[model samples]
Target: MTNVELKEKIIEYSKEIGIDKIGFASADPFLTLKDRLLEQQRLQYQSGFEEKDIDKRVTPKKLLPEAKTIIAIALAYPSKMKNEPKNKKGERRGRFCRASWGEDYHRVLQNRLEKLEDYIMSLVPEAACKSMVDTGELSDRAVAERAGIGWSGKNCAIITPEFGSYVYLGEMITTLSLPPDTPITDQCGTCNKCVEACPTDALVQGGQLNSNKCIAYLTQTKDFLPKQYRKQIGNRLYGCDTCQQVCPENKGRDIHSNEEFEPDPDIVKPLLIPILQLSNREFRENYGPLAGSWRGKKPIQRNAIIALGNYKEESAIEVLEDLLLHDPRPIIRGSAAWALGQINTERSALSLYRAKETEKDSDIVKEINEALDYITSEVRYAK
Candidate 1:
């Protein structure tokens, strides 16, 4: 079969295998993207989780030497949960971002890509291809936008006409020179809801994102969340969806075509207090399947502590104190200290004082002292 025929066959196969959208693009270097990446590096806007080498990120040929065509795929995830749990006063819950609502999307996208790769190899036995999901050297959004899968939105999410911004993207670079698709025009126009609604102002302008200020990036970080963003994190345990949630394009988009993308209410909106006390193995068993858990238990536990403080659930004070005093990870201990201060009860103040004396880590000690100062200020102000 000709490359044209093979491309059509692949598109048909993609639909059969449940890929929501598939698009093709030339394997040319992403020249504009390279410039933007360098600018992001210069401005120190990267999330640190991104692939550092801009060359590998921009040049498809670097990834697959014989690269001629790129295939971009997007899988729609559920935007709204069914029978979602409610966060009551004492029984407060923290939320994993919608992208993380169901199974780990990397696995879901990988399964589909692997099938496509196998099918392509079967058709052209000598075809060379390399597939990657979020962690890939090449940016999935850049590939998708170039392949006409979606337009790059102001929030930096690829916004599909059919599924809006609520989709998981992955791509494959191949030696088969399939016909490239036309990129979609930017439809954001004058609507700046996503940029204005960002609590941290991570969205610099229309297409630029400062990942360091992004709450989604902050939530995944293993270190103590910066003080300003901690309060903004609210009940988010894993990722932030504020930008997408406020986007006019994503307004009514809620697709549940993939069962793997369907959320388990209990897991996605898990109770906050229990998370603090969970053992590492227990955490893995409970949360390992979700994409949000990829950073392991520390970040989630720390965020959970912050959420508890945000809620000021008096019931959580005991557990937060336990973590503040006993948790080995300084991030968790320090976050717990901050949370206790946010709670700002007499018991929390006393706990911070007791922990302050025993805490050897300079940062944790500083956090404890700061928390104590906050409580002292609160008490003095009240008097």
Candidate 2:
């Protein structure tokens, strides 16, 4: 079969295998992306989770020799949950971002990529292919954008006309020569809602991000969250959606086409207090399937503690107190101390004092002292 015929067959088969969108691009070096990445590095803006070798990341041939084309795939995930649980007084819940709603997208996209790879190999017996999801060397967004999958939005997300920015991206590099699709025009004219709505101003400018200041990156960190950002994190247990939520293009774009991407309300929007008590095994068993759980239970539990503080839930004081005094991890204990300070009750203050006396971790001790000071100032102000 000719390359054009094979490409058409691949597109038809992609639809049969439930791939929502597919596009093709030449395996050229992403020179523009390389410049942006260099700028991000120079400005200390990277999230540090990306592949460090710039050459490998930008050059397709380094990943797969004689690569002729890249097949970019996008799968739309649900933006809204069905039968969403309400967060009430003592039963407040924290949320995982929309991307983390269902099964881990890594596995879901990998399965699709594998099937596509198998089909391609069957057609071209001598063809070589290399596939990767979000964790790959090549930038999935850059490939998708080049392949006319979507326009790169101001929020730094690829905004598909059909699915908005709510799509999971993956790509496959193949030796098969195929005609490339035209790049999409930027459609985000004059709309700066996403930039304005960023909670931490992590979007330094349109198409630029300072990942260190981003709540999505912060939620995945294992250490104690910085004092300034703790309050800004709100009830987000994993990832941040403020930028996407405020985008004009994303308005009324709630696609639920993929069953695998549908959320289990109770799991994605889990109660904050109950989350603090989940043991390692229990946490894994409950949240193991979701993409948000990749950072393990520590970050989620820490965010859950911050969410309780953000809510000022008086009922959580007991649990926060227990965590403050007895939790082995200093990040948890320190976060608990901060939460108690946010609660600012006399009982919470007592817990901080008790923890202050026994806490040997100097950092945690500092957190306890700060908590006590916050409560004392609040008490005096009230008086």
Candidate 3:
């Protein structure tokens, strides 16, 4: 069959296999993306989670030799959870971002990509193909934008007209030549809501991001969160959605096309106090299937502690104290110290004092001392 015929067949099969949207693009190097990446490196704005080799990331041929076209696919996920759990005062909750609401998108997208790859191989036995999801060397958003699947938004998310920005993107590089789609026009004309709404000013400008300051990147980190951004993190346990939430284009857009992406409210927004008690095995068994759990239980638990601090939940003081005094992980212990300070009651102050006396880790000791200082200042002010 001719390449055009094969492309048509692929598109039809994609819809059959539950791919929400598919677009085709040439496999040429992403020249514009390279310049932005270099700028990000020079500014030290990267989150350090990306592929180190810039050449490999921008050049599709480096990933799949003689690649002629990229087939980009987008699957819409639910933005709103049904039967969402309420965040009561005592039973405070931490939230996983909309992207992490469901089963790991990596697995869902990979399954679709594999099905598409097998179908392509069936048609052209000699054809070569390489598929990648979020973790791939090639940027999923860049490829999707190039393939006309969506316009890259100021929030740094690809915003599909149909699904808004609530879509998981994946792409396949193939030796088969196909007609490429036209790029989408930029729709974020004068609206600066996402940039302004960014709690940390991570969005330096439209289409630019300082990942180091991005809460989404910060949440995945396994260390004690930087003091400055801790309050800005609020109740987010996994990722930040402030930018997307404020975007006008994303208004009233909550697609639930894929059942696999539906969230379990209890899991995605769990009680802050109980999260502090989850053992590693229990955490894995409960949350391993979710995308937010990829960084392991440490970051999530640490963020949960921070969330409790943000809420100033009096009931969480006991659990936070236990973590501060007995948790083996320094990050957890230090975060608990900060949370106790936020609670700022006499009981919490006592816990900080107790931990301060026994805490030998210099870093954790500093956290405890700072907590004590904060409590002292608050108490003096009240008096």
Candidate 4:
């Protein structure tokens, strides 16, 4: 078959193998990726690269020397899960934003991409693929735009007529000389809803994602989250789907995946009480299969407590207080104390007082005292 015929066959087989979208572009490095990469570097997020002398991404040419095209693909992940309340309830009512509520799309998309790649190699014995889903720092979003899959939105996610920004992107880098598709144009149409809705103003007025304030990066982060942005994260434990939720292009798209992306019912709008009580081992077993566990249960479970606090639900007080006493990590203890302050119950007050008496960590004791004072004031008002 000619290269054009081969490209057609590859994409057809890709869809048959279960990909939601498949398009091709040349293997050249991303045209507009340097500026974004520089910014990501300034924010200190560029550590995930191979610093070999050969310019790992665009050079040494041998690995991709004869490469004529790259296949940028996507698989649709469910936009919403079972218990995630619809937008009608009000902002921040749902548990997760949208895209992340399901199982990790990376694993599922990669598995399917491998099948397609294998089939291609069978037909062209010399074909080999450096296939990856969300790996290799190749700017999967950028390449997807070039391949006519979608255009990058102000939120930096690829958007197509059918899937919007809800699709998960993966790439197959290969030596096949597939005919490339024409690039797509930006369809944002002066829409700044995503930038405006961003709780953290991470996106500049135009359309830049300052990773430092992005909740998706913030929740998965290690170390301390700056106090200012912590509140902005609201209840998002793993990823934030807010910007996409408000985008005009994504409105009313009924796309959803029925594969490994299905969520565990308990995780959907989960009760903060037991989640705060989970031991490291239990958290592993419960969330390991899900993408939310990528940072381990500590950060997510910690954020769950914060989300409960954000709700200001008095019923969460005992749960937060209990976590204050049992949580081994100071970070968790500190967050629990903050939630207790927000809930402000008598039980929480007493626990904070007791914890304050024995606590050796100065910062934690201070947080406990703060929670105690706030809760005490609240209870007094109620009485």
lDDT of candidate 2 over 193-240, digit per residue (tens): 888999999999999999999999999999889899998999999999
Local distance difference test values of all predictions, in order = 0.92, 0.94, 0.93, 0.73
- RMSD of each predicted structure: 1.2, 0.7, 0.8, 3.6
User: Which model scores highest in lDDT?
Assistant: 2
- In order of appearance, the predictions have TM-scores of 0.97, 0.99, 0.99, 0.88
Residue-wise lDDT of candidate 1 within 306-350, one digit each (tens)? Answer: 999898788888888888888878888988899899889988888
Clashes of each: 0, 0, 0, 1
How far does residue 323 in candidate 3 sit from its true spot (Å)? 1.2
Model 4 lDDT tens row, 117-228: 8899899988868877665646677778888999889997998988788888888788887888998888888888999888888776545677667788788876555667
Error of 4 at 359 (Å): 0.7
| Per-residue lDDT value at 180 in model 3 | 95
Alpha-carbon runs more than 4 Å astray in model 3: none
Tell me the RMSD of model 2 versus the true structure. Answer: 0.7
Better of 1 and 3 by TM-score: 3
- Better model by lDDT: candidate 2 vs candidate 4: 2
Better of 1 and 2 by lDDT: 2
Q: C-alpha displacement of 230 in model 2, angstroms? A: 0.7
